[model samples]
Target: MSTTAERDPGKTQAWGAHAPTGLAGWVIRICHALPGTSRIWYRLTRLLRGPIKRAPVRPFDVNALGMELRLLNRGNFCEMTALYAPQFYDVPELDWLAAQLADGGTFVDIGGNIGLYSLAMAHRLGSRISIHTVEPDAELSARMRFNAEHNGLSINLAPVALSDHEGIATLKIDARQRGQNSLQDGTANGQADTREVPVNTLLALCQSRDITRIRAMKIDVEGHEPRILGHFFDNAPETLWPEALLIEHVHDDNRLMQRLIDALGYVEQGRTSRNLLLSRASTTGG
Candidate 1:
């Protein structure tokens, strides 16, 4: 018999939880001093588990980095990162993204997942900055919504997948790791363990939302970064390209992605364990 981490409500081990480190870890300790109501919500979700078979949610609110965020214990990256103080999540990437953004600018998170990046950026840069978080997974999107509301943060939530084309696509959900879900064409199509999600090209989303300026963007779409960005490059108006970008670099198309970014005049500035920080040449001082 196979173990049931996916189907069992009692799965409790965060086998790969975040081991907070460095100066970021110190900041996490400082921000850990705030109060949250997630304790009540977690017990509530646990009571609902017997009826639902699997508890789809577990509330985790940690006040860190000057903001409070509601998180979900979903047996994925959230377990690995967001459960800890936000500072410990991705120190370098978090700092880089925050520094590149301005107070009144706009930011887009293509695979917003549980809204950690959105929370971090908004908290660090100030609430005046408009943020749009895009996450296609039904469960994760729900968590994103809950977190945003609990933190008293206002942000645009795009509950659809982003793709090279506009329309519907099957999102392949990982049975165990929630963060591993993907809408890429290379993934299995129309399988039983999938959900058909609405998708829109980047250009279409901006136009529909009446967004004219995108100051910075952080994209981590599992393995589909190339396709998402390919669509952006092909369709986005030149004047609308984000001045700063933080893209996941550990994908199959790393080389191709580098070439495409270079062609668009982006210069590699730094990198974290899972991402490459890039800034457009036009945005730099002459």
Candidate 2:
């Protein structure tokens, strides 16, 4: 087992507020002494991260030395074609989520990339809470399903797209890196052909499925969060709202996001590294 001392020197320096100078650092310096090793090291490190599995809990636990996470990714879903890396969003997001759990409620993960938090909820929390994971990418959806099975979990995976309405929509896929937030808007670099799918409002889908009492939600859809949020608010009952919302605030759209969330009647409650977690007023009559 690697102790904190034997671990990466950079992390040790970061924790101690000191400059790193050690055998590992010297080795790295020597490696960099060789021509082109620096860029090669950078590229290699960037290419593979981990589903670095730890002891199996309910949802799979992983520590890439980034953040401690309890979630699932397809065992086959290794990081390929660099793209946008999976950040530590799930760690704090899941911690906050653990705090917000209502005894037996539903948790919906819109734009669930690869079942990280969704699987965590199912594994850690169990059947007390229902889980609905929605991912548009077919490959990612497959991976999510695989991870679910790998963990013997029973999460509902919606492999279709979710939007304001039902219709044929062109899904702009960043084919080279499917995990990067691909959009329906035709602006992404490697968008593919239009695929039509039925779009259903969150409330409508919940009602149809007889779902009640939502505990929390995690939404990361690059820049389309505003639109998805708008539709949810438009259809949701004023009283029935998520206890917490962990959303990605990617661009410098603070004002825009505030306006949109305000339209939904959410006040900024808190923030994690790249996400905002909001809560409804407790005083509001449910």
Candidate 3:
């Protein structure tokens, strides 16, 4: 089977060359000709920025899978096309999430980035599900807030990095990759610029919100995923554990991560090259 990176060129490659300057571009041009859409089209073009990492960030919206997501695509070429013109989001994981989360179910998004997972869940599942999204970037968090409110979705936003410990930690950011920020020493130990951001363990987050019964969870915190999850699975009660999970597994540490989840009685259900989906052994598969 093809990897997620292979299935979606935009996921890892610069899409400016393969993108529909052909058919997709033609349809976008047609949309521009329609009344009241010209402005949006123009803004969308600005958002699909070039390969300059220092370029000004541009905020725009694009419909993907089933959600209309707000994005800041500029300055990151790979993320721009992937998030904006996305060939396809994580279909397998998304399918599992949709099948598992019933109305009134609870979902948690760690390292929410721009809250694409949250928006997609709310759009597909409606106001019945409560989504708690954790992200450390103030700007991206605000954009996520805008998308949730504009779409009339109920998403609780927490603007802090979820780590194994509480208090402040140095968050390392990729100058070129906005989604690659993390609290791991490998990512944070460099002389590359860092920021002291408040951190909280998943247990603390859930307790503060009185949130329990998490049906599903998605984690994508660069290299910090293992530590974040280690804290949860080791300490959180079985009731607080999610029945389904989507975690980015494209890391060197993921070999150990599998053992960690296995010890918690979770079984791997599916994979999408970039991520893995697991279902708890104690819970029935959706």
**Candidate No. with top lDDT:** 1
Model 3 agreement with the true structure over 146-205: per-residue lDDT tens digits: 667667778889988887888877776655566776674323444565766788999999
Write one digit per residue (lDDT tens) for candidate 1, span 35-117. 33444443433343232224444444445455555444455765434554343557788877777775468899998877878
Over all chains combined, what TM-score does candidate 1 have? 0.75
- Any idea what lDDT model 3 has? 0.67
Model 2 C-alpha lDDT per residue in residues 214-267, reported as the tens digit of each score: 777888766766666667777787666776777878753536466646565666
Candidate 2, 212: how far from true, in Å? Answer: 2.8
- Give candidate 1's whole-model lDDT: 0.68
The CA lDDT of each predicted structure is 0.68, 0.55, 0.67
TM-scores for all candidates: the values are: 0.75, 0.64, 0.75
Worst 10 residues of 2 by lDDT: 50-59
Candidate 2, superposed: residue stretches over 4 Å from native: 1-89, 185-195, 252-256, 260-265, 283-286
Off by over 4 Å in 3: 1-56, 76-79, 82-84, 184-192, 252-254
